[model samples]
Target chain A: MEMSALWKLSYGMYAIGTLDGERPTGCIVNTVIQITSDNPVIAISMNKNNYTYDCIKRTGRFSVSILSEKTTQNVIAKLGFSSGRDTDKFDGDIFAWEYMDGLPVVNENSCAHITAEVITMTEMETHYVILARVQDAKVTSDYNPMTYKYYHEVIKGKAPKNAPTYQAPEKITDKETWACQICGYIYEGDLTKEPEDFVCPICKQPKSMFKKQ
Target chain B: MEMSALWKLSYGMYAIGTLDGERPTGCIVNTVIQITSDNPVIAISMNKNNYTYDCIKRTGRFSVSILSEKTTQNVIAKLGFSSGRDTDKFDGDIFAWEYMDGLPVVNENSCAHITAEVITMTEMETHYVILARVQDAKVTSDYNPMTYKYYHEVIKGKAPKNAPTYQAPEKITDKETWACQICGYIYEGDLTKEPEDFVCPICKQPKSMFKKQ
Candidate 1:
């Protein structure tokens, strides 16, 4: 019964775009599969606690932006690390987007994009599996896509509690390690010696989110 | 925009266990989601064309055996490349399994085993997503799980047409390339002069399934 073998499975990162009334918003999701070919249909699993779920329920539409290896770490940091409820996720002009199906899709250098309309949503106790029909799709790049393993190994990212694959971070052996309370990014070295305003590189959270351990 | 960055999503490969009447049989699936926590529920997407789907439809129950990184390629060759319609997939004692919720579960080697009953099913054009509640669950191993990416890279396995992510193999540039007509595993070098015992590595189809192109 080896659990390590499960790591062999492949996955691609994506940003899901949806709207609440006229406000455009989106979140990160790892599970997106095409269920049909003719009139192509796709599905995405979103945690019930996510704010994007409520927005998709209201708008009945969403878009998928396929993240490439070239995508900066800030994409996941901006969309995944914080809740859209607190701040406007797209406010900083950090991402360039376009309006489609009445929603904002991150056009900031992605590999491919797809806009879909929610056809059905099945409620599970903790998550919502939203099946949708692809309305439009386009290719953005030819670079190789970044896999989840590469993200963990290269980007050194951690899954949040709201993520479908949420697992607690492994305890670090570093004598002085700090973890971001928001996104769970672990800082190996000391930060107190630096400026009091030092922020997390992944989520941009203030040093206050860091806890000495 | 680099398309290579599209790969950072996470996914795990799994052997979906089910009973064909009283006999044990199964197939491979990449999508498995935990829909609920309390009275836990799980959802899996199966292609309508796969033999495993019909078996689950008849039994109304199935077990999800989360494959670990240690899972051998032979297991996939047995359960995935070969069809249960002709051969007894569970025969030869290849996997150690037990009946749970009236369905067989692979207990020999997996991260975790979960048995569930099909509570609801939504039919898509090419596939069916069955939403089920986890009737029983148990940890089988602590090993890291096998992801789809690892399967492609390490095992050199390709997705079948029934898979949601199946993409047509890229055309070969070299002449005298022999391709498997059944599952599309291609032999780039000259294969015509090979022994008469040549068989498709993927589907185990006879050499007759090969086409000269």
Candidate 2:
């Protein structure tokens, strides 16, 4: 199969927030689709290994924070590249969030938030397709929701390894590309030209964390 | 719940092509998502009432035509608004298509095509989540794939009743708007000023079929 063709299938950037015991924990996902109109059941693909997946499976409740274009990459760095098991994704001042239905949701810059209760968890080889029914939802802003295309092309973000749409970084032979070791974000030009304080846009890692490719 | 918040969940415009016995038939869908990256598996939600759903269930194989921005609204009208049970959607000269892995797929103006074999069909309250493994796929063009936002905001096209994301046409009170009776496409202006041959850009219906709001 020509796997690259699958990249044409579009998606949106989202954070799946649920509680691990009393701790607010979550991770980034790109595959969220409404499965029905009335009562609005949405389906999201989560890798089985995701800590957030275990939380949602146990709690039976979760919140979908629909990330917008204006949403800073810091949100992705906190909730995506790192594991919720070790890091308190919502504890610091990286982004503002609020509890909806007892689940933490990104409040600032996100376009909307939907609280849902899990209805079914269908197992696949490497992922679980969690189907949930909408419990409550609200529009947070008028910002355009960030699409996977915009995230990759405009923000120069890289998908987490657990993402269903994640593809390996292509080999670069034509440019002086530097890849962020923390998040795999590629800096296309000479990395030294930037300020000493310049960090990886996607992961917020220091310049020292980037290695020449 | 503020149901309008669900609009922030993003999606792509696609044509799900499958066979009705020996004839070719399909419909438009916005909820196609990959569930795995290695030996990619995709999941698509199909409303139980759709004719194409039964066809895919019976045949156990289908093709996805990743529609691009250049793909005309005619493709949506032919494959979306009409039913394959009564109408031969692919018989006319409306669009170009070809068979891949014994299933028909849109050829021109589409970015890619993927043929898949059904892995499982999990029943839901109003729809069935059909999971399939990719059998073959090919990138057809370099054109940007169309997102659901672009389809509604730019093309002014309405979703079919069977779609998971289908929303009722909101009442427009502020302006002189005319809605196509066939496809529910809203044209925001006096319909009388257009040329005699000005068909509804969505379903190609005559101007007489439009009703002022």
Candidate 3:
């Protein structure tokens, strides 16, 4: 199979929020689909290794925050590039949220927010397909929901390694570049020339996280 | 739940082709999602009542034609608006296709085509979520794939009742108009002023199929 052909499949960006014990934790995903209309059901594919996946599996509840073009990359960097097991994803007020039935939902730059209870899960080798019935949902903003394609081409974002739709690393040119060890954000320049305080703009990782590539 | 919030979920438009006994049959869908990257797997939700859904259940193999913005609206009108059980969708050459592993794949205005064998199915009250592993796939064009948002706002297409994503009919403006009973193409202004041979531009159905709304 020519795997790149799958790129034609469209998807929206979303932050799946669930709690790890009492801590608000989540990660980014792009495979959410509305399955049924009446008492609508939604399906989202989460990699088995995702910390948020374990949280949802345990709690049986999750909330989806639909990210839009206006969304800051920091939200993705904090929740997506880093593991919720080691990081407090809701820290430093990177995203605004309100707790709904003990679940945190990020409303900043969100087109909509949906809370659902897991009804079923179809297990795959690397991922678990979670089917949830929408319990409560609301439109948060009129901003256009960010498309995965837009995230790549417009925002120049890279997918987290654990993302189900993650593609293998692409061939890089012979240009001097510094790549983020965490998020793989390629800084196309001579990194040594920049100040030590420089950090990965996409993932907000420190300069020490940069690897010459 | 505010179901309208679900509308923010993005999806690509597709022509789902499968065999109905010995005849080639298909329908339009916007729910196809790639679940895995390695040995790619795809999942599509089909309303249980749809004829094409039954066909896929029997055939065990199906092809997905990723529709592009350039796709003719008639492809959707024929495959989406009309029932394959009653209409020979491929008879009128409404779409261009070829046989792939004995499954019909429409390639006209398609960004890609994927042939898959059913791995399993998740049963829901109103739909069946078919998970299939990609057996063969090819990128056919460089055209931008048609998104469901573009299909609705740009193509002005209405969802067929059998579609899993089908929404209730939107309120129509009170005006002198005639709508095609077959495909819901509304013709504004006095319908009586049109020629006797007037037909729904999208569905190619005759004026007799129109009803004042």
Candidate 4:
């Protein structure tokens, strides 16, 4: 079948937040939907192997921070590409966040925030669909929230194995194209000789971010 | 905090197929997600009040036909605005579909067809998150999949009260603009007097299909 057709499905990027014991932790997810209106229930699909899933299982609570276009690449690199098991994913200047109901929430230029209590979980082979009831919700910004399409076509972020929208890496086609060292954005033309001020279109990193293969 | 940020989230329009007793029926939904890769699992959020939800509970099976940009607005009006319990939603030429694994599958110029078996269900405050394992899958066409954005901006389709994405109808700002009588698309200038051959930018319906309000 045409797998590319499935890729055309639109989605939004989000940072899922939860607590691991006394420490706050979370991961990135693209699947979060409002399941109900009256009491405001939501559903989120998460990989069973994710550290945030384990945390949610223990705490029975989590938060969804709707990321905006202004969110920096370092935030995704720390909370998404890196595993919380190996590093303190929320530590340092990479992200600025605060605690809500004892759970850490990343404030990395997000447009909205929602905290929910897990109501049920259904296991589906490689992933878990978690249904939760909204406990606290707050609007944070007027910025436009980032779409999953924009994350790929504009931000130039790669979907890791855990992402529901993950696609197998594409083979390189041309020799003149240069790839961003940080976000893997392919530049179709020679960027090396451009002014030193040139920045990566997807991640907005400076010219130093580009590396030739 | 800006609640308007929710406007940035992207979604798709679909006709969720199910069986009602010996008859086939379905409804509109905006929330569907691929939960896994290997065995291919999907999750859909449906309001408890929808007739299709009851049908799915009894049948334990359903089909998802991912609508394309080419689908007619009448398909949504026939299925979305009317209740199958009282109306023969599929009667006349309202919609063209066939039974698949005993459930109706819409053939309205969709991008793909997915038939799944219900594995688990979680009850939320006002809706249900139905997780199903895909049993059959097929690609139907190469047309661009219709996004919720395209539905609103192009076809002028509005989310029903039972839809997870339902928002208060936006106020119309201009009167000179000609709106598609069926899907609500507003053209920059009046096209009603144009030859009956004029077509809508969204659902692709001919001017003959529109009725000026």
Candidate 5:
């Protein structure tokens, strides 16, 4: 079986929002699918190990922030690359966000959002297929929703290890590269030639966070 | 609740293949999502009324032909516009297709296909959420997969009523148009103006099949 074939399956990137106690937390996912139209229900696959999955299980509610092409790589780095258990994903006022139905939705370059209540959840070996009923939804912007293909081919981003689509890194040989230790943004060529103030383009992390990969 | 907000959720077009007794049958859908990467499982939302759903229930297996940007509108009209219960979807040599793992996969303009076995299913009011384990899969082309947004805005195709995502027809304001009775393809001008030989651009059905809208 050609595992690469699975990459052809298209998906949209999303910031799944939920609350950890009174604190808002979430993670990025690509497996949200609308299963029913009337009383619209959506199913999202979340890794069991994800901190956001535990938050959703406790709160029994979640929100979907539909990421669009305008969403910056920093938003992905803040929400997707880091774990909520270790640090506040929304700290430092990194993402311009707002509260909707008591759930915090990352509004930076998001086109729409849906607040949902967990109706049921089926446990998979590696993930939880959580089915949620849409409680309320709103269109945030008119920008086109970003497809996973666009994220990979255009933004040149890689999936986080917690993502269901995550694959082990393949050996890279294009040039000497510096990769962000926080997010996996690759910086091509010599890092020493850059200015002292330079930071990771995607994660906005200082040069100290980059390591030769 | 803004129903249009649901439109912001992105999706990919796929031709779902299954078996009718010993014959091959399938339909087009936009709700296939990979649920897990390890051992790679997927879930597809199919309306209970669809013939392909019944086929999968009985056969316990199906294939997903990932349609790419290169896929023609005719392929969507064939598998999407017609009923697999009576019509031979694979008949009339409509698509250049072949079998993979004893399942017919529509190859024309397909980027990849996954043959799967249904492990379990949850029945909703109008649809069934089927969880299937990947038996085998292959990448057929390197072309980018066609997204549902591209199908609507670029290909100008409309969804069949049976689709969970189908929206009610919008009020039309253009010069009197004719629509295909089978595929709902709108002809911008008078169908009578074209030669009698002219057929529906999407379904290729004769002019007699058009109805003034």
Candidate 6:
């Protein structure tokens, strides 16, 4: 099978939110599709390793923040690249968010948010297809929803290691490249000549987090 | 719940192909998402009323043609707006297609195609979430995949009545509009002034299919 064929499938970027006990925690995901119209039901694929997945399993509910074109790469980096087991993902001032139906949701640059209660969870090898019934939904802004294509091409962002669509970075033989240890974002040019305060745009990590390849 | 919030969920345009007793039959769908990466599995929502759903359930196999931006609106109209049970969707000169893994798939203006076998079917109120494991997949072109938004905002296409994302056309006031009887595409101006043999760009139907609103 041609594995690259899978890349042709289109998707949108989203931030899935759920509570880890008393704290807010979540991660980034690319799969979210509506399954029914009346009493709408939606499905989202979450990696078994995701902390948010464990939270949803415990709480039986979650919130989906539909990221917009204006959503920053930092939002993806903070929620996607780090583990919620130790760090607090929603504690920083990087993005604005609020609670809807008792679940935290990103609202700063998101177009809409939907809170759902889990109806069923179908297990696959590495992921779980969580089917849920929409309990509450509201449009937050008029911004256009962000497609995964826009995140890759326009924002020059890289997928997290646990993402279903994650592909290993291609070897760069033609340029002096620096790979960010935090989020795997690559710097194509000389990192030493840049300012001391330069940080990885995707994950907001300092230059010290980059390693020359 | 604000139903408009559901519109923020993003999706891709696709043509699903399957066999109806030895004849090729399929329809257009917007919900297709990868559920697992290894030995890739995908989930697609099919309305219970669709003929193709019965075909897939019986045949236990199907194909997905990832439509590109260049795919004409007529493809959506023929395969989506019409019923495959009574009409030959791929028999005309509207679009080019070929059989892959014994199932017909649209090749013209498509980026890739994937053939799969059904693994499970989870029933919902109005739809079934069919999970399938990939049998074979191949990239046919390098064109950008078409997102549902592009089909609506750029091609000016309307969703089929059976689609999970189907929304009733908002009443147009203060303008002369003509609606297609077969498909709900509305022409914002007078259709009588176009030509002697004007056709609806969406379904390619003749001027006779239009009705004044």
Measured by DockQ, the strongest candidate is 6
Q: How would you encode candidate 1's per-residue C-alpha lDDT over B96-204 as one tens digit per residue?
A: 6677667766665577777788999899988998888777776777766777765675445454435443332233433457667665455667786778898765567
Residues B1-213, candidate 3, lDDT per residue (tens digit)?
Answer: 678899999998999999999899989999999888888888999998899999999999999999887775656777788788787877755457788888888877789989999999998878889999999998999987888887886556455544443332222345676767878666778988989998776567898998885
Write candidate 5's Cα lDDT for A29-118 as tens digits.
998888888988888989999999999989999999999877766678778887889868876655699899999898887999899999
Which regions of candidate 2 deviate over 4 angstroms?
Answer: A157-207, A210-213, B157-181, B184-207, B210-213
Kindly list the per-residue Cα lDDT of model 3 for residues A1-213, writing each as its tens digit: 777779899999999999998998999999999888887889999999999999999999999999987775556766788888887888775557788667898877789989999999988888889999989999888987888887886555354544443332222345776668788666766888889898776567799998886
Fnat of each prediction?
A: 0.34, 0.83, 0.75, 0.45, 0.69, 0.85
How high is the CA lDDT of each candidate model?
A: 0.71, 0.85, 0.82, 0.73, 0.83, 0.85
Which model is ahead, 4 or 5, in terms of lDDT? 5
Chain A TM-score for each of the predictions: 0.74, 0.77, 0.77, 0.75, 0.78, 0.78
Show model 4 residue runs off by greater than 4 Å.
A1-9, A157-213, B1-9, B95-102, B157-213
User: Tens digits of per-residue lDDT for model 2 on B15-80?
Assistant: 999999899999999989999999899999999999999999899999999998777666777789
Interface RMSD for candidate number 4? Answer: 5.9
Residue A85 of candidate 3: its Cα lDDT?
85
The residue pairs found clashing in candidate 3 are: none
Candidate 1 local lDDT, A96-196, one digit each (tens): 77776566777766777778899999887778889998887777776446566556755554444444333322334435777677876666677788698
iRMS per model, in Å, is 7.6, 5.6, 5.9, 5.9, 5.8, 5.5
* Candidate 3 deviant stretches above 4 angstroms: A157-204, A208-213, B157-204, B208-213
Off by over 4 Å in 1: A1-12, A96-102, A107-109, A142-213, B1-10, B93-102, B107-109, B157-213
Superior by TM-score: candidate 2 or candidate 4? 2
- Docking level for model 5: acceptable
Worst 10 residues of 6 chain B by lDDT: B164-173
Of 1 and 2, the candidate ahead on lDDT is 2
Docking class of 6: acceptable
Docking class of 1: acceptable
Clash statistics: count for each candidate: 49, 0, 0, 2, 0, 0
